[model samples]
Target: MSNKVIKEPSNQLEYIISSKQEHEYSKAVNKLFDLALTYIEDAEKGNRLGRKAAWTQGVFEAPLFYACDTVPISAIDLGRLSSRNSVQIAEEAFDLPKETCSMISVLLGEWVLRNNSSVKRVVAFNNACEPFNMAYELIREQGYDVFRVEGAIRPKLNHDGRLDQVIKFLSGELGDLAVWLTGKQLDESRMAREIARMNRILAKVRTVMELRLKNSLYIKSLPTMFILMGSGHYFGKPDEFEAVLDELIDELNSSDVIPSPLGKVIPLTWIGARGLEFGVYKAVDDCGGALLSWFTPNPYDRNWREDVPPLESMARYILDYFLVGSPVHQIKGIERMIEQSSSKGIFFYHYVGCAFGGVHVEIFRDYFKKRGIPSIGLDGCFQVGAPSGQLLTRVRAFIEMFS
Candidate 1:
């Protein structure tokens, strides 16, 4: 009936990460888990306080739901609880294809377990992989109200006129989504306020990223991932999340942490979606590699422009997302992260059944290969412990090559 039901496993993951070092930033990590617990508890109860709860297909849509005075919970948040079990349930009970994205399968299984869940509204975007689009439809078929925010396709030529049209189109779509959820127009001021709060959180995350790049030894890959992942939905509490970010930033800046010894740790850039298995981080760590930057979430570096109208700014933010843009743009972004982090290679960890990045693994690998930057593509799923021994072996070999 309370968070106690799911708190133990979440804390276990946190303990594993925080136990790695004696940094003060561990306090912030604790805060993040606390926030996630609160959100998960409220979501299970179908609402938070008095706010209506809505399942968000992705993190980017959380801000919009916040503006609408609704609680937005993501599948990523749910999958963090018992991903391996969820995937098994999806396969055995739901009869979902094994080829379905593991994240989607986990979501479906979670939804099934919570059949009595009072939450009925769902918000999703069309820019994601096809599996997600199909998952939304499946959720809708079960009688949950689903509202999708349409995305714009990037044009071949970049021009202000075309860009403006795309923004306008997306703005209208967002406006419609707001009205559908609230039966009233979205308040621009309220949306702007939410954007401002998130921007503050993001600014702090950027500082953490810089700190990690400078001293990768201070915070390990798993903890760094936890921090960046929180920015997606602020773990359902923007104010508290911002405070946690500030604490983390202060700890990183003031701590007397030393960089790793030269030739001891291989600095690498990860260019793919967030990994679900803890072993993935462990494999890299065990292999003497420290991920300096994660490219997928880095698109959040482009903060919402407060100078512009809230709706228009939101549109621009969605359009400028790395996945929504061309492969060339994504590659360019990856190049920048490699250069900035002085990374020795790239780890393209693509999720199985993810058409977004999984299908393009070879392109990224070939591009980096021609440029003399070693890259490896490891196919994985969202289930916990899904990282096979063979996958870890490949990771070890890759790091050994750098050595």
Candidate 2:
């Protein structure tokens, strides 16, 4: 990573998008770190434009920060800045249980010694799972203002009133948070504009995803996905982020980009959490395999209804996503991705200590087998690295059986 001082962007969205440059993500990650560090400094000087709001996980909307004049950040995004050695050492130093997620342990361990004096608040959705909820309590005890969002009950997209109710519920919570943080009411108009821009970004992401599936552009596309997932919470300005997405979409759609020729290698669909462990999937791609689909909360799933309220739009987006609600809802999403990408096998990269994903791995593995889709369940930490040596051997053997 570069030691360059990260400058606050004249245009925040442009700056954020620039920090997540594809093919040079290490530099981007460095820039993001510097950005966070800068924010901390500003907060200390009482010169900050917005209060800091961090999601416990990656599920929350980033636009909420803009509406409330808060800096959006996530531990998951910052996880990219953590070295495997650092996380491993932190885990050992903390003496975390063997069953704990190293990624969470790393954050907890590091936070203990670090000065996060700039952070004033933390927000988490309840649906993130049990382990994360426990982690949130620890974060609260560290003196940050912590708030919990009782996330929507698994509501179907087709259910008319359910989504409306969910939106109303979250909107109330967000409105309260904005007022409490900034001493101003939530600017519905600003949120509407931001949500509109988010919708555009979502469209571009969907386009990239479709192109990726059509051409097996997984290797080229994951960085862009990461950008979308991280940029919103990284103090991203909306208009610039949209422009960046447009450029990314153009690059992905270019004729020079050739599809992967992994002929017999079974392309896998990643379920559960996507860790910051870089190059894991690319290693598989290099070994005659390809990643067909990498799932995350789908922002584009919302109905871009002009008449609908922005809060409702965000609610619809959150509720309609593949990761929301029940195990059955997620299973449907997984099966759809598998079919859409023409994947021959499923890789349940179950994060250790994630109860939800761990339990689903067995169910989905059996379900995939029953449906004639070969499945492999691999266990590792959230910041876990690429499959190598023995793990790589197992992945290759799994591929060989079907190939």
Candidate 3:
């Protein structure tokens, strides 16, 4: 029997899997995902790292969303740039009072609930998200130095100057960590100048990457397979990441793949892993229904809360943009994502993994039923490929019956 909707997901798979041919499993797969854990363990050993973030030569000491998420652990030693963990790492490292920093950490804690382990230090934070911020405090109590990244989001990207400035400052200060982490030194002057440029490139490249993955060429490669892995780190050098991204672009241009479902193409919504990998076009084609998975899909996160950060930074836009008018912020993205389905049915996979998301899938199933969308959650492992074929059949059968 020939399955329909087999156009491979060349563009979207990169977000899920790191490289080409990632659908196939190899012995080294787990090694790729587990690398970040090693760093946290090494740091706990308290001997692998030097006091400073060695940033010389060509190393980029980046910030990560959390100390314990897959990015920090899977990306091991690759320059884990920590996000403010809902707040800046600097404020906590210096012993600032509980304020916004605590709130940030609360969100950070929530983000890390899936498996947080990489953060070595924390910054000052307020209690916005609650007990989550408390975890950072507990980490510091244990004698590890967790620094905070500072500033708040002004609702407008332009007003985020302070945040950007802090990023620049930290990029310089973490110079020592770069050498210690990447094992390379650089010309201080050259490194400093390149930092901003590198920063620019990251933004530019992400934009380019997003656009390219959505193009016509990627559509031809149907039913693509994605193997997921992360080094669990965020910062180091933009050049290296840019190189990986560039390589990805080149690969997508010259590859053949497949997608799922068929062109009755409905929107598919996935809430797991990071804000990458929702092969909307492919999923739409597979199910013969329209599909729309967020870059970082979460159910509870309905608006622009960083706790709600997705590939689309989808928080504000969904509430404001989608015009669905959600009362409980959680409804905007989650409901809207599935509501796009004219087929009145949806198949959701609550990934047992995390790069950037985790919201109650049960919530979706229940709520969508009320709205008449009929959302279903599929059980599976995290990051590794090859979900049960029986499960796939169930999904296909459900879609067929609906169609």
Whose TM-score is greatest here?
A: 1
Tell me the TM-score of model 3.
Answer: 0.41
Q: lDDT (0-100) at residue 87 of candidate 3?
A: 38
Cα-based TM-score, every candidate = 0.89, 0.77, 0.41
Better of 1 and 3 by TM-score: 1
lDDT per residue (tens digit) for residues 1-403 in model 2: 2345554332223333434443352433344334443433343344244444544454456666677755565666555544456555555655557677766776765455453544546676776666667767876776756778777665656477766677788767766766765788878888887666665666765676676665554334245445546444533344544555565556556635444466544566766556443444444555666675766543333345446776666666666565566666666767677777788776777666766777766776777788887777777655533434566567677777766
Better of 1 and 2 by lDDT: 1
Evaluate residue 389 in candidate 1 and report its C-alpha lDDT on the 0 to 100 scale. Answer: 71
* lDDT measured at residue 72 in model 3 versus the true structure, 0 to 100: 27
Q: Local distance difference test, per candidate?
A: 0.73, 0.58, 0.35
Candidate 3: Cα lDDT at 180: 34
Candidate 2, position 124, lDDT: 69
Deviation (Å) of 236 in candidate 2: 3.1
Q: Which candidate, 1 or 2, has the higher TM-score?
A: 1
